[model samples]
Target: CLTGAPGDAARNAAFLVDHSDCPAVSLAGDLSLAGLAWMFSRAAGVVSVNTGTMHLAALAGAPTVGLHGPTNPLRWGPWGRNVQSLLPHSGACAYLNLGFEYPDPPVTCLENLPVSDVLDALERMGLRERAFAGD
Candidate 1:
C-alpha cells in the first residue's frame, strides 16, 4: 500500500493484520533507496504507481503491476514484459501528459477501475492462481 508519511500506515496495517487471516507486511513512511532495494529483493511481485519505487522494482527484475490514472501508461509505465499497467478510460483526466502529482489525483481514476477489472488483469498476468494443489 502506498501511504504518505503521517504514520497512520502502521495503525492501518495493524488493523488489517488483526482483522484478516492472511499475513500482512507493512513498511511505513517514506522509504529510502536501500529500503526499496530490500523490499524488491524479497518480494514475489510489485504493485505500485508510476513512481520511482516502481522503476526500482522493474530494474530489480521483479514483475510490476502499475496503477495509472492521469498519466499515460505508454509513456510512463515500466518497460518490461513482466510489467502490467492499468489505466482509466480515455479523458479521465486532462493532465495525462504530465507526471504524477496532486493536481491529477490517481485516486479518482483508480476508484473507477472495478475490483474485477483489477483481478482480471492480475489473472492475465498470471499473478492470480489457486493457492495449492488442493484447497
Candidate 2:
C-alpha cells in the first residue's frame, strides 16, 4: 500500500504504481496525517526513503526501514526500537551535515544502495516475510 498526501503527490507517484509488481493501493486522499500514522502503526513493516513519513512511522512504533543517501543517518535517521536504517555502501554521500547546504552531486547517491541489500536488511529485521505476505 502506498499512502501519502493526495492530489499532486499521487500524481507524482503514478509511475511507481504503474511499475509495481505486487498489489499496490493508494490511500492518498482517504486518510488524514494522524490517521495515516495510525495506519502505519498497524502495518507489518514499512520501507520508506529518509523522509517525514519515515520519522512518523518510527515514532508511531512501527517496524520501519529507512533508506539513506545524502542524509546522515546519525543526524537524521528515524528514532525507534524497530527502526533499521540503510546507508549507501559508497561513502560518497555519507555524513552530509546539512544535505541541502551543499550543491547537488552529479548523480543521486541513493542509487548506490542496491535492492538486494535492502531485502537483506528487511530479512535481518524479520520484515520481509510479513511485509511481502501473499506477494
Candidate 3:
C-alpha cells in the first residue's frame, strides 16, 4: 500500500499506481495514527518518500525503504529496525547543507535518481524478489 497526502499529490500517486503493473493501493490521509500503526505493523514492507509513515513503518519492524532527495538521511531517515534509506549522490545537490531546512533552490535530485538504482537498493534490502514475484 502507498499512502500520501490528499488532493493532487495523492491523486497523482494513485494514477501512477493504477498504471503500474505492481498491485498497490494509494491511500490518502484518512487513516488515524492508531489505524496506520496497525496497518504498518502488518505490512511485509513499506516504500515511501521520506514521510512519517516510513518512520512509523520502520518502528513497526516492517522493512521500510525511505527514498530521500536533497534532504540528509542521517537527520530525517527512518529509525529503528528493518529500515533502509535510498539517498541520491551528494554531488547532485551539493549546495544543500546537512540538516538544512527546505532548500531555497528547488532540487530535482530524487527525480534524477534512476529506477534501476532504487531497485538495486531494494535488492540490497532483500525486497526485489518479493516485489516482483508475480512478474
Best by lDDT: 2
Identify the leading candidate in terms of TM-score. Answer: 2
lDDT of all the models against the reference? 0.66, 0.81, 0.74
Tens-digit lDDT track for model 3 on 90-118? 44643344555565565578766667877
Name the 10 consecutive residues with the lowest summed lDDT in model 1.
126-135
Cα-based lDDT at residue 27, candidate 1: 56
Better of 2 and 3 by lDDT: 2
**What's model 1's TM-score?**
0.70
Local distance difference test, candidate 3: 0.74
| TM-score for all models, in order of appearance | 0.70, 0.84, 0.78
Tens digits of per-residue lDDT for model 2, 22-120: 466777678888898899888878889998999999999888899988788889898998888898888477556776655455447888899988898
Q: Which residue pairs clash within candidate 3? A: none
lDDT of 1 by residue, 13-131 (tens): 77777878644545557676777777776666777777877778877777777878666778788876588888765446425565545462344566665566666666777766632
Q: 27 in model 3: Cα distance from truth in Å?
A: 2.2
Residue 25's C-alpha lDDT in candidate 1? 46
